[model samples]
Target: MTRILIVGGGYVGMNVALRLQRRLRHHAEITILDADSYMTYQPFLPEAAAGNLEPRHLVVPLRQVLHRCRMLNGWVVGVDSERRTVRFRPHQGEGYDLPYDLLVYAPGSVSRLLPVPGLAECGIGFKTVEEAIHLRNHVLAQLDLASSTRDEAIRRRALTFVFVGAGFAGVEALAELEDMAKDACRYFPAVDAADMRWILVEATGRILPEVGPEMGAWTLEQLRRRGIDVRLDTRVRSAENGRVVLDDGDEFDTDTLVWTAGVRPHPLVRATDLPRDDKDRVKVTPHLTVVGRPEVFAAGDSAAVPDLTRPGELCAPNAQHAVRQARTIADNIVARLRGRPLREYRHAYAGSVASLGLHKGVAQVYGVKLRGPLAWLTHRSYHLTRIPTVNRKVRVLVDWTLALFFPRDIVSLGALAEPRKEFEFAAGAPDGAKTGTQDGTETTVPRPAGARF
Candidate 1:
């Protein structure tokens, strides 16, 4: 029996896996190994952060969806293409190896980080569901801390939020969170909406650069009208010790810093001996087959597939392209198995949609520009249709319905991410501290006088 192994479970991975199962029957054994057990619909992350959608509903469980395929929840630590074997470390089990007749490499992208000072420790990237939830909690927690503090400077610092990217992720995250914070002000009398500041810093001259210049300018105008500080052609010099110093000479103290600047292919792609492009993405032919390796295929953000439609351009790393490319990849795989001609992957670029908030957004679809409620509706409709599972789609709709009848839940659950930190700090010990139990009495360990928590 032929064995097929797929890495990563994002849009491309899941889509291709489903397509293969539907096309290949039981002749091939399909196995998908992802670092996370659930597939996150990344487009809904901004809304998840704003409490407009439940975080749990944003993820589709692989076990439930891919029932026919063997699902291993683990990280692919190494891939030996010559041996036709892939090694992975399961979430709670020992390392194992799986031999594959054909391999599909789709380990999606990671946060593209720069060498900015203090960014590693203080910055949050808007990619994973964990990051989105952490950001939502952190922002609401800052409001809580601000309301409880009597120091004006401390309150102001807590209320200031800085986003380093003006692209779709950064802009939508900022807009939704800002709207949530403003609505949350009704409950906290001490913290006024005017007291909060939301700033977006982009290195380029305009944001949403994927969209045309006119729509980008219109987005800028809308954001500015909402009192958001949109700084263009600006860069961050440093953000050390809660002090954000911009290249444009503006300096401020802000506790919240989000870095959605960009994304690069996962580092695991480099481990393979396959050919790669200048950006470190695996180089693949128009048929989405890795160069010089007919048994290996790659797609989504990790593969640099040739865009035959444009002749010189590479496929963009967006859901629209990824979803479409998955179909071609599945078809090509079946073709190769059956000794038939494979089809090349090609698709024209569709327009973009960006949600500013609940009733505010900008969209450019098929050369038509739209803004305000129309754009917002388009944004919702497009994502609604794109989300993988019908169960998740209905749950997300219910979440939206609940939001209409009730105020957004602004309570922060920061401790959920690090629940033991507070206990360790109070016990005067570091993480992995020793605790003694005698007759149900808990004894805490004491730390050295100069030791930090």
Candidate 2:
């Protein structure tokens, strides 16, 4: 039996494994390696951050979804394409080499970071579920601190939120966070909506550059109407010590700084011996096969697939293109195994849609422009149909249904970070000294001279 190895189980890896299972009858053992056991639906991240959707519902468990395929939760550290061996670093143990007859390289992208000072310490990227959940919890905690503080400067800083970048991830995350934080103010008697400050600093001249200029202008107007400060043609120079310094000479103190600038392909591309483009993307033909290597296939954010329909253009790295490319790659791979001619992937660019907040959005679908509640409904409907798994769809639909009656789940369960915190507190450590829980999972953090948690 042939052994096929699929690396990085994101949208591409998951789709390839499932499609190959049905298409190929060559009796191959398919194994998938990924850092996380679940695949995250990134479009729902903003809603998850704003407490509109539960974070858990955004992830599809690989073991449950791909029960027939062997799923391994580990990191693919390096790939020796020439030797047909992949170096995998297991999550809980030593690293090992896995040899395969055919390799599907689909590891995706990572947060594209810049060399701005203090960014590593202060900035949070809006890329993962952990970051989204932390943003929600940290924002709610900030409100709690602001309401409890008597000092004006500290209160002002705590209530201030700054987001750098104006693309979909940045804009959607900022808008959703601002909406949720403002709505959460109702619960804090001491906190007023007026005290909150939401600022969006865009390096470009306009936000949502994917949408046309007119739509971008309209989005700017809508954000301005919501009292959000939109700084255009601006750059965030430094975020040192909670102080945001901009190129326009404007500076402000903000507790939260979200950096959603963009993403670059994952480093695994360079780790392999396969040929890559100047942009560090795996160079693949129009059929999703790595150039000059028939046994190796690539797709999704990590692969630079030439746009056959449009000259001098590469496929944009987005969910729309990623899913289609994954499906095409799977089909082409099966064709290669069965000695059939490969099919070329040629897709036309579709319009984009984005949500501002609840009951508000902008959409340009098939040359038709829409805004307000209708656009918002369209945005939800489109993503609802695209997100994988009927189990997740039903769970998310239930979450949406529950939201119509009860209020949003704004309460921040900060203790979720340290699940054993309450257990530690209840263990009765005399004089707050070091002590262990009954389960032996507690770690004692000695209190500094006058420090507070």
- lDDT scores for all predictions? 0.90, 0.88
Could you tell me the lDDT of residue 393 within candidate 1?
Answer: 88
- How high a TM-score does candidate 2 get? 0.93
Q: What would the per-residue lDDT of candidate 2 be over residues 151-236, giving only the tens digit for each residue?
A: 99999999999998899999999988888888898999999988898999988888998788889899999999999999999988
Candidate 2 segments exceeding 4 Å error: 420-429, 432-453
Error (Å) of candidate 2 at residue 52 is 1.3
- List model 1 lDDT by residue over 99-155, tens digit each: 999999999999899899988888889999999999999999888889999998999
Segments of candidate 1 deviating more than 4 angstroms? 92-94, 421-453
Candidate 2 C-alpha error for residue 173, in Å: 0.6
Worst-scoring 10-residue span by lDDT in model 1: 444-453
